[model samples]
Target: MTSTAPVPDPSPTATTPASAASRGARSLARLGVHVVGDGVDVVVLASQASAVDLVLLGEDGERRTGLLRARHGLWHAHVPDVSAGTRYGLRVHGEWNPAAGQLHNPDKLLLDPYARALTGEVSYVPEIFGHHVTDAAATHHGLEVRDDRDSAPFVPHGVVLPASDPVATAERLAARPRVPWSRTVIYEAHVRGFTLLHPDLPPELRGTYAGLAHPAVIEHLRRLGVTTIELLPIHAFATEHAIAARDLPNYWGYSTLSYFAPEPSYATRASRDAGAEAVVAEVRAMVDALHAAGIEVVLDVVYNHTCEGGLDGPLLSWRGLDNTGYYLHDGGTPARYADVTGTGNSLDFRRQRVVQLTLDSLRYWAGEIGVDGFRFDLAVTLGRKAGEFEPDHPFLVALASDPVLADVKLVAEPWDVGPSGWRTGEFAPPMHEWNDRYRDSVRRFWLADAKALAQGGHGTPHDLRDLATRLSGSADMFHRFDRGPTASINYVTAHDGFTLADLVTYDHKHNGANREDNRDGSDNNLSWNHGVEGRVESGSPGSELRPVRRRSIRNVLGTLLVSAGTPMLTAGDEFGRTQQGNNNAYCQDSPISWVDWERTGWQDDLLETARHLLELRHAHPVMRPTRFAYGRPRSNDPFIDLAWFGEDGAAVEGSAWHNPYRRVLQMRRAGGAAANPRSAEGVAAPVRRDLLVVVNGALNDVDVALAPSRTQGWELVWDSVWESPRERHESAVVDGAFPDAGTVVPVEPLSIRFYLSR
Candidate 1:
């Protein structure tokens, strides 16, 4: 990749952790080094060494050794003759000290930091593991002995390639489809699982890189009205040690090994030599195809930690090259790793070189791979320094300033296992964060409390008002920043937790299938199993849960899409796909997490309802909040335009904030100047009131008085109470003032309704 900035100031101190490897190796006769890019020709310089040799390997496994060129305090070689596609590794001649983090046995071949392609999967072995012990307890602390066995046979070798014009590639890709934050609808999906069960995909292409670029995949997204597809982590990851022993793999792709290369396992035709580059090109082509159809691709990235485990972890690229420099080490000792990422060691951003490495990797993916955006996994770790998490951390600041990545979508998981980890709305402006409040509030209002509301006579109006606040772009969370409604990414479920289907079917997490003994998932799900837990008998009306489950799904899904801010839907939620009660299926690559393309008769109706809701969102400008709405901007409007109303249609007062049974939410998205004064819909210019959304979450029927509009006619645009197609009524109701606003509209328990003034 082409860097706009001048080469980072040449360092004199070698204060960086890699200094240890350089100092120790120089004293030995076998230590050797060579520079490939912008410097002097071959010249070997050794002050205390007995001998040194440079080793370069090619695709045919032939090794070429030459004397290294000596430069200012280091060996140098300008191999402009060595074009791209060269596969090479380093063999340092030095002492193998296990305690000093400098294990240069010369038998272990190391990967290059700038390598673009990796030949195969990096297999873990006792020799490559930092420790010398076969015992589990001794290795856990990272103090293990070094084995003499050659790990090169099992280790994946990095491939070199000729440099390409990164600037031109970025320019063309940037011009592709890039919907603004407000208009973007994210569809979170696993590349393999998404198309693995897709019957329409070609047999040869199914579950591969080619399958994602297929027309059928594009059509499905187009019909769903998705602006971006948020793919799960695609970087090459490893199966956890425990899972490997159990014969299962890390299905979520969280353990990243190669940051620049895509996983070759997902490709159909693979070659040990150029397979990674081919897969990268194919994935890039998929992005191009999606862009042509007006869709963007956002990768879920893992940068908090590498596939390398704690202390006794495998010596992959980072550890093999420079363990102390790549990972955050203790300030006093420098040997102990700072375990902030929870998944072993955290990447040390304190060093400028480390920060550059991360930014360089990000630029390579965005500029070279052609992705539209990235959702940082455990973003809190990225902002963390030695002691505190700074919002203006260099990595984030650099990313925001870089020309190629500045315009691309930047999302944050926003929390980590570190101290004070929940920084939801704390991201800098222009960065949208996942809204957990929206998810929790929607769940409590629609599903959990629906049972009490159905029994009648006890629910309050405060609950409904709070629900409306989340529906209004979570103004409380983003109200502090200039970033409008686009700051919140609203959703009911995400990949880390339960699927939407499981949210209603099971009251608690069923993760025994994960082999973690049901110990890996969350406990506070706030889910309500209507009557029987898990799946009930088919067509058995005997369970009171049937109607309630259906109603809850409709209300939550409707609220998510119609609510302010961008909405993200987990794949398979539209068709009611379930994990069969398993909440955490991170280790299961099978059908458990895959979308079951075949749906039951009733499920088809649910899918249609989801489609209709998305269509309605596209049809109405009010549902998609272009700008955040501040309550009552106009003094003349009696209702405050977007006022909170009690069940009686009166303005809710002080006591409503804590009301548990409150199940009626009324929103008058009126007030604000419309930009287009000539549009027939009157939405072009923000007039006083364009749309009103009334949500009823009670179990028994309740009469909600719609505010009587004297000047306009009220028409029903969409209702989630009834099934699709027959869902909305054709005419308008001209009801006069409050108490008797409209006809006694019976809002079924856990239902959402949308009305527009004609």
Candidate 2:
């Protein structure tokens, strides 16, 4: 829980050589390719290279190479007469000892990790690999060999960005939508998938960043009440060799190549054809447009590892630059990478240069590109120092302390494949974590529990206590470290797993199209098909099944929105979009992955239900408590912040929490007392309405007695039983008000109800 000291900055300094001093003096005090004065200054961190050369490709296809002066682990040079729009790459000459983790080859063109814009696509051919064609067998056998083939024809080259106009950049930052964390409702989406099928967007703009900024897209997000759009990785990434060979792309974009550049493919074809600078401007325009619409943008960044796989992988940017310094190699054998991320190689956070690179990339995106925050993919690896995850690792501390980054949102995935990597709720304060436990518990409560009940099971596999804990902000996991409810990003479904529609439509994943023969994705999905597997046609013989499935979806959505935490809704889940039961659709980039604008009658209803749930969340602050509710009123206060009760209107106690058969529970939050809750700064905050949420996980309808309280009356505000929004809202208000105590309420089977106390 203690804060770690900030890592000291290791700025590059000039050495005794006059050339090094001259180059350092002229270079701007920033990393990457920058236009300084009359020439472009290139700075690269090549710690272990014997020689570093700046290779430039002219428009006429002429190639020129210049040696860079090295000093203190950094290579620096000022190329005269060179300006922005110049295409460039790096060539680091070093030993080819694969056993010792050195796979440098000057013949293989390398990318600049700090490249602001990258042009061309990486053609994954055998020439791209570092090992010789004949010695390729040796690589399989764990031996090192050099490949003499040139990779210049197939590699992506960095394009020097035009000098950033400080005034323009400032204006863009000034226009950003700095949404507060407490008010943030993140909608995790893909830059391409989100608008790919939008009927209103122009065909050219579809699947591009510009398309995401279209008015129709903005209106939809606004209608759904999303504060931030957490985009899937748009960083310049390479399709994995195997996936590409199979004619499949890395759709999720977890494999990042150039951290600074936006993926050019996400830009319009016109922008791409115009070159990298145009692509950069297109992304900026998207951010600006979203900001104008009052929506913050958060990138899902992959800093845990690079596109380069293990020793047998291609010699891309990092692996060829300085393998030992950039990546963590096996302790016993330096040649092999320590695969903590299951991505072949984990970035070495122990090295200051690697840490600097990550920090620099973050700052560039936040500062230059005008992004609001980042959701780190496989974030646990970033906190791993000396082979174990630490809450206060130096890199983490630096991130939390950085002037530019500290104010922005920092969400962590919170787990990896490394030893003891599941550190959910263990990260330090200000670091919100994705709550997988919450996802599982909610799924079990609604979907799995219903399935078990239909199978003649006695009760749920687990009691309602876990569900209650998660609904009340997961205090057991986060509160020990003084983190508040907002620290837990509550979600029922994310992009990695089954969609909300699929959760109630399929019991098992249908991943046969992934070419893995239905073996990929998680087995323990906690999903239930609700009496029928796969998609069930409307008006089928099993007509009752559709109603059950729709109610199940509402149950999960209600729990997520009414729960105490920041709620994140997957993009297509709002309208019941499904990948046809494909849980792991990371590689399916076709129509299967895109958000179809075409909707069924049920889908429209589902979308309306989702909107209503989000509206309720925003209207009632008790559902999103800033602090953990302990069921005790403040000093001399007549109302309790939160209280739980049983079906008989009595306080829940003892085995009642462990009773699996007891599926009905009532929770009441003190609206009057919460009207003016105290803020962290000790200021009197705005008043929030008190609410009572009733949940019934049983298969049959039951009468629930309202909990005894001092409130004057309770009015039914929302119910999940309604099939349409008109039905839900028109008959939302109960005819008669209930007394403070001893009132039996008719609760539906497997549904939730919300009441506002007056």
Q: Give the per-residue lDDT digits (tens) of candidate 1, residues 669-691.
A: 76344455557764444353367
User: Residue 714, candidate 2: how far off, in angstroms?
Assistant: 1.0
Worst 10 residues of 2 by lDDT: 1-10
Clashing pairs in 2: 671-690, 675-687
- Model 2 C-alpha lDDT per residue in residues 1-758, reported as the tens digit of each score: 11112222222321224655676766534667788677677788777776777777886763544445456678776666678888889877777777677677877889989999998888877678777654222233443557778888898999998888889878988998888877889999999998989999999999999999899999999999989999999999998776776678899999998999999999999999898999999999999999999999999999999888777778889988888999987676545778999978899899988898999999989998999999998889999888989889999999999998877899999999999989898889778999999999999989887789889994546788999899899999989678898999999999888999999999999998889888889999999998778887777876778888898888899899988889999998988998999999999988778999899888898888888888877777666788888888856355788899888889899988988878888888775454447878998764445788889988898888877756566777677887766674466455354445568877889989888776
TM-score for candidate 1, residues paired by index? 0.86
Off by over 4 Å in 1: 1-55, 58-76, 80-83, 92-105, 135-144, 165-171, 270-274, 332-334, 451-465, 540-544, 634-641, 678-689, 729-743
